[model samples]
Target chain A: MKRAVFKNNWVAALMVAPQLLIIFVFFYWPTSQAMYWAFTLEQPWGGGNTWVGFDNFAAILFDDLYWYSVQVSVVYAIGATVLSVGMALILAVFVDRQLRGFKAYKIGMIWPYAIAAPAVGLAFRFIFNPGAGIMLYLNDAFPGAWDPNGNGTHAMIMVIVAGAWKQIAYNFIFFLAGLQSIPRSLLEAGAMDGARVLRRMRDIQLPLLAPTFFFVLVINITDSFTDSFGIVDTMTGGGPARATNLMVYKIFNDGFQGLDYSGAAAQSIILMFLVVALTVVQFRYIERKVHYT
Target chain B: MIERTPILNIVTHLILLSGLILMIFPMYLVLVAASLDLKDVSAIPPKMFPGDQLWVNMGVAWEKAKFGEKFLNTFIVAFGVVVGKIVLACITAFGIVFFDHRLRMPIFWAVFITLMLPLEVRIVPTYAVAANALQPFQVFMDVTGLTWAINAVTGIEVALEWNLLNSYTGLIMPLVATATGTFLYRQFFLTIPDELVEAAKMDGAGPVRFLREILVPLSVTNIAALATIMFVYSWNQYLWPLLVITDQSYGMVAVELGRLVPKITSTGGEVAKWNIAMAGTLIVMVPPILVVIFMQRWFVRGLINTDK
Candidate 1:
């Protein structure tokens, strides 16, 4: 209610000053710079630019490599999202059936979110290293058949696996929450008709959990899109001839390494729009259905 | 509880345990790799068991890799971000919800835009802005002829310099404005009964006094939960410090751990040993994992709630 008003504009300004100043300088200023550079021609090192309208966007839109990066990002996001969400859904469903050691599963499962993407990347690097770690035995049997370091396809797999590993813990929590929210009477109704567990889950539980599934789908895709930087940076640095070069990583590569400020800014704009578009779609789709609980 | 077959229960355990193994395997790899010596690590097939050089490798990571300084920097940055975010978010939410302001919604949505574009997107320009923070002061000097003005006024010739490039403020200041935290606190505040606000008003307390005395106390649990998540998030930030700080002294553990993986020495020789890298990885993981484990309940609730 607006009735609890502290009627002083100065006090309000004082309170909102810190966040406003920070967001203005860091977020809005940088964003505007990126947008301006996206529309101009700029020298990364020389730091002077000419106003060139739509050339950067035109080049990026027409470039095969840029489109390739987008394709790789889509595949990576889809692979990561599907793998994590599917495994998490399975784990959550099975765990929902048991009562013995839920605490252990809960503790063990919620941990990946704590571990950073780089940490996950490094840990998986150890495991997936061909010479040492867990992959050593496999290489011993296959000689040269399994080498993620030299193989583009396998490199993509490595990144996807690590990305998915990072996401599953998050997806698992949501799935578990969603599973809990399914009414017990619905399952009982299915059981009275002699439906098996699978049938009951397929008919009653899955339909009821559709909202959660949709919610998880949006979250997983968005997270996978933006958060894949760390995993890519650590695991391969978008290596093997740019096979695993995701869109975000390409931005960092172009700007920092290649010093293509304008190109990178345009790419950043595209990626920003991609995220905003996903967020809009999520809210618009879920607004009508998210309140089922 | 519907009918539970013993077979199905066993299968459920089987599936869950397998999932657990998948989740825990990489962690096991970290532990195993860290424990092995360079010889064992570089041998024909990798050693799976813990070796005797665990302490040695950890010492190398600690002393040689300069993780001690990195730990201090990371600790400072993370705690700074956490405290800054919570305090600003609380007050901002308090202002938005309890106080009357024309720009409240506008300010709220302004913070919310940060959630759309992550740091990875605008990293270059953000770095540009951070690196040249003294530009405005320079322009001020030129515009007003402030140097001559100051000399005329006080006879002190001075120049302004803001070397925030490699400092803690550089690392944390750019990161502290978050919409999610403010949104959560606002949501929590919306649930606060208006009678409480009215009561505080009847008692002739100002907004600051009401916030300090009432809203802060009511928000302890939410604040703590959000703090756990933010700490992990800030601790795990990969690109912010990388772009801002160039000095080796200010290197972060996450960024430095990436450096341990050296290139192949020669065409025929073995690569750099990973024992130290794995040890560094373990050290990097300890703080956040411990945070998650200790704050399990709050962490879980906070992540699921804030995200959804």
Candidate 2:
């Protein structure tokens, strides 16, 4: 019995060795290096780094540009999240009613999410091109119509609209799946209680779909705040003189473009804290509202 | 049943129809613009109808972008990444689940923590590693005088002259290990009952045989879903490729499309060819859109199950 147990343990260890090696090299080591580099002011050309404890963090916190970026990111995240999730809920409810050719619409709706962000940004840029863009044409037809690149506000709005357009489909697909999983008998029970359709949706459906809503909210926020540099990089390049700059785009610019590794790492560490705090708040406060079933 | 009313139904349909139209109009514009002539493309309000310059514009874009070679490069890189990820993720997940040991828990935690560490955080270090540390083994290279062994093993000649900087290896190698794929497969393998594995072991099926015959066959749905997701992701990846690949002729479609936009000058007075850029955008978005439309059922199913 003892020999068998020892042999099984040895086999298990042998099998697990490869996976552990990959995780250590790819995930753990790189992350640790990033954290370490945040404190050292290393030069780009072989110059040794000086230890500037808390200076990098303090610079980011005190800078006006950093504050502006954080504000813009929050606004974009909230706007995109609300717009996408609201539209998704409405679309899912409509599709759930068994419309003809629902599958085609379902497929079409989810198509945008699969397209690469840079490609989507490029497509939208063309669609809104100043001379030939349909939106430009429509704006020209009306008096005092604003150009997308005319000002910071217009540019910010355009980015948010584009982000929301790409994200709604993702939210819709998930909500549709969540709606499908809810047992019909409960809905039938609500109906039998003389609950109006609106009441049924408000009282039963909304509460039941809370978990999916929470999940979508988290994902949308993460994508908008953290992963949108690709789109911004391709579309505006944080441009028109930094009008559309967000937190992630700022980090990319500071680190990779400006070659300020310590500054970028400091910015990244700040962003990391923001993400963790938000996630913790969500779990502590909003998790209570989720109906897991 | 009597509670049902047409008023609510009409309202719902109207909303859905408008949203769907909004979603599709950009793609439609791309198709229309791609087919238009340069003269027609620059016209006021831009012509919505297809023009006679479809082949001409395609030729111009192809020549300007050196698109054929770029497309081939992207295909090789994307396919290689997809295959590598699938094999690596499957083997890793299998090793984690089937080979239960004390080390498994810590390894699992390490993978889980990666979810919080965004790629942006690790880009600088990862770039350094790719550039300086990792190099192809030269023991099997073709040049004999260079102190590198030149030999063909299994009818395959290993080549080292190909610098990864502007090639397919640069595009694919950095993306081999995906945290999302690993997590997906791990969650999926958990659903398989232990009894099946026990039975396979009783029949003298080793780890390799059990994975080949039993685990892989039963996990087709999960694998298909993951493959579709990874393929689309690999094809559409932009940021990393943009940073690493400097040569225009070897970059992906997204990079090519981005170069279409000219840098804005102080005057902002140039008459840009909006039609051509729109056309290019259309071409770039087609493959992933088609993939999603055809394989949406599996994609949606995958997203729903991912949290589990």
Candidate 3:
């Protein structure tokens, strides 16, 4: 809605055509097809599908394994979010103090952001190796102290740590930015009132950082649900009695490996709702905070 | 720095140092493993120091995994996505902002709706569409009776099909079909002063000329920023390439590295080659990490802006 604009329909259509075609074919078409497949049961062969109504949903809802995947996905989303966001907040607060060597620490911290999740998983896999890793020393004090491969809970902890490690850099950047955006006079006023560093942070700085904190929490949770596939696949493979079978990984496994199209599509629909709900909350509340800040 | 307490400053440095160690230690382990031989790497207590076999292990992993081709494929796909996304997004944003067309709002909403529908959600059907890039056209032809008409005229059956699986186009195209670039460009376009457009018109610059001569030159920084983000995102793609590219020639390094990790189920008989696995992990991480480091300023801005 600029004041000066071109009034050519054909040129505008030509320019927009490629993007429209791409989204329609790649984004919209597949989305609609997923909705279709969710309600229909496809034959094992290339035969046509039967309209199964709510059968797929019913089956998935009735299955205890599906419920377990949902449970673990929530656990991971919260666990990774709490760990990463908490660490990032602490690091950001220290860096915000403008200590000597803050710049180097900032750069060093965000290095993990550049590393991919699966690579993070692999690196941690090496580090948490019970045989020869740093854990080996601990195992000497108490033999059989660390074993991620055999123990399901240990595997969950390993993946959570790896996932959180990769996320710290991202959350740190945001938390640092949020801290920097706060008015210096407010902190100075707190200092003038004889408030110490932690006092100022707890009272003035953290309240102002609430918006960024919430935004990062929503993003981290969504990411843990969908983006943890790489970590889970590389490190645990949802192993030791399906301890880490996150919903996203389960959808892929069921659709591709298990060849249960309707069931996987149903799961996709459910995950889509979860994402859409989170996105709605983001736009509804977070955007307002952006404007306010 | 307001009245710093000596004890608190020391504590701050200590905490920051520990944070740095926690962040860097895993990567340090990878470097250590990559330098050691298989026996030393899998020893009772891990060797903590670097050895002279760094290059040797890298070469071994590179050869074993055919990383030469994998790296090339990753480069091609990454560059392809960058170029494709930038071009399409630039033109679309140009059309939406510069032109007063009737369909502009609808088109914007169309792109906006895609913000919610990530490829991970509709992965199965996206795989189907990618497996046959021309399926929609074939369906259209069949539905509209164009197939029958063409067949009757040409005395042949017509079923248009083009499989994109295992090709560079398949790997690049789907990732390019996103709203991130378009939204970035649109926001940048809105910031351009209206006087520029008025001046261009005064000088008899049409839409295309204005875009080429005026808008594009001004967008260099934005493009550079988006390019850094897009390159890393494309290079780090795993699931799409894992599904689409079955051929070793098109294997992405991330997926290939994942495959190199010995499954926990296979632990008893096979001694995990932590040395080679760590070597491949380092090799795979190099390009994206280099891009982020070199373009640190733009990369950070791009990350924050893209979320906005």
Candidate 4:
């Protein structure tokens, strides 16, 4: 028995080696270096590195720009998360009903999620371009309606709308899949008990979808912080006095533009901690409310 | 039986039609803009219909964007990344499952932990390592007199002088190890029945033979799904390529097209050629869009089923 167990164990280790090596080289090594660099000030053009302890972190904590970026990121993450998950839930419920052309609705609704972010950003850029954009034309049609390009506040709104539009399709797909997994018999039973469609959704569907909703919340929040950098980078470039500079975008600028390796690393570490803490809090406080069945 | 009421049917169709319009409108506008002459691009309300400048715009875009070379570069980069990911992911997953030992759990944990570390966190250090490693490798090859042969096959020679920034290897190397692919394969392999392995063993089959003959054949669906996902991901990848590939000389179609419109339009209030940019954007988006439209049913089904 001991020999058999040993033989089985050997096979598993051999199988995992290549993956382990790749991960070490690509993921683990780089990650550790980033952590190390967070404590040291280094020049971009290959020079002597001076250990700065937590000075980078201290500077970032006190910096007005950094705090503003953090605030923008948090707001964007929370807003995008709520809007995306809410829209997805609504769409999922709407589509779950017995209706003609259900398949078309499902596919069409999720198609935007399939479009690349750059492409989506470009499309939205064109749509919201000052004089030539359709949205701008629409704004013109409505007198005194906010002009997106005229001010920083409206520009940020446009960014959020574009971001939320791109995210809604992704969230909808996940929620639709989750909705499909709910037993049809339970829905039928609710109908039999004289529950209307909205009542059924409120009483049964939302509770059962807690797990999927929770997952979407985590994914959207993380992605809003990480992935929205591209959209913001391309669209606004964190413009109008850095009003749109979210945390990840700030990290990108710090690392790539400012060449402040220590500052970027410190920002990354902070972002990671925040994400982990948020995920943990969700799991601890809200996860218990999820009805798995 | 649930009754399909007329009002509900109308409402559902309205909702779906509106969404479809919204999804496709931007693409439609791009096509229209691409066809129109530059003057029409910034016209009030934008051009709603196609114009005669489609060919002219394509010509301009091709010339301005260096379309041919960039297309080839993008293809090579995307292809290399795809091939490397498939090969590495399969081998690693196989190793993790078959090579059982005291080190197995630790190795597994290490790979799994990468899922939590976002790629942005590690970019600076990874760039440093890539920059440093390329220098010595180049010198060693030049001294050993194997530079030509290495260059011919691997394309690493061009990569030595930071020319690789816009080259195939630069775009592909960073994307070689995908945590999601490994996780998927690990789960897929775990489902393979022990009885099948035992039967193969009884016939004196080794691990490699059993994997090749039995496991590979049964994993077609999983492989197809993974390939589709990876292909879409590689096609959509923007940041890494943008970071490494510095020259316009070696840009991908997406990046090149992105640069061309801004560069051309920003010159002297010539009114940025919305049409050309739209056309280029549409062209860049076509391949991935087609893949999604065609394989969406399988893709969605695969995503849901593979999670377990």
User: What is the TM-score of each predicted model, taking all chains together?
Assistant: 0.92, 0.88, 0.96, 0.87
- Tell me how far the alpha carbon of residue A107 in candidate 2 is from the true structure, in angstroms, after superposition: 1.4
Cα lDDT, model 1, residue A189: 84
- Candidate 2's error at B59, in angstroms? 3.1
lDDT of 2 by residue, A1-293 (tens): 01111125565565556555555555555555567678888866777788888888888889998888888888889887888888888888777766666876777678888777776776676676565646656667884465667667767777777788888888898888878888888778988998877787789888888877877788778778777876777666676767788888887788877988888877777777767665665555346644353
Task: Tell the DockQ for candidate 2.
Answer: 0.38
Alpha-carbon runs more than 4 Å astray in model 3:
B148-155, B266-268
Q: Write the residue-wise lDDT of candidate 1 on A70-123 in tens digits.
A: 999999999999999999998988787645787797777878778888889987
- Taken over the whole model, the C-alpha lDDT of each candidate is 0.83, 0.71, 0.88, 0.70
Question: Which digits, one per residue and each the tens of the lDDT, describe model 4 over residues B9-42?
Answer: 6776676676667656766777777788867777
Query: Lowest-scoring 10 consecutive residues by lDDT in candidate 3 chain A?
Result: A1-10
Candidate 3 has which clashing residue pairs, if any?
Answer: none
Residue-level lDDT tens digits of model 2 in B1-308: 32676888777678778878978887777777878876665567668777777667777776666678767877787788778767777777776777746777777776666666566556766554445322223421223433323332344444434345666766676676446677788888887776777788888987788889987898787777777777787887777777778867678877777777663323565555656666666666777778777777677787666532
Q: List each candidate's DockQ score.
A: 0.59, 0.38, 0.70, 0.42
- Which residue segments of model 1 deviate by more than 4 Å? A1-3, A43-47, A183-196, A291-293, B134-163, B263-270
By summed lDDT, the worst window of 10 consecutive residues in model 1 chain B runs over B263-272
Between candidates 1 and 2, which one is better according to TM-score?
Answer: 1
TM-score for candidate 4, residues paired by index: 0.87
* Model 4: per-residue Cα lDDT over A37-68, one tens digit each: 78888765678678889988999999999999
- DockQ of prediction 3: 0.70
lDDT winner between candidates 2 and 4:
2
- Candidate order, DockQ descending: 3, 1, 4, 2
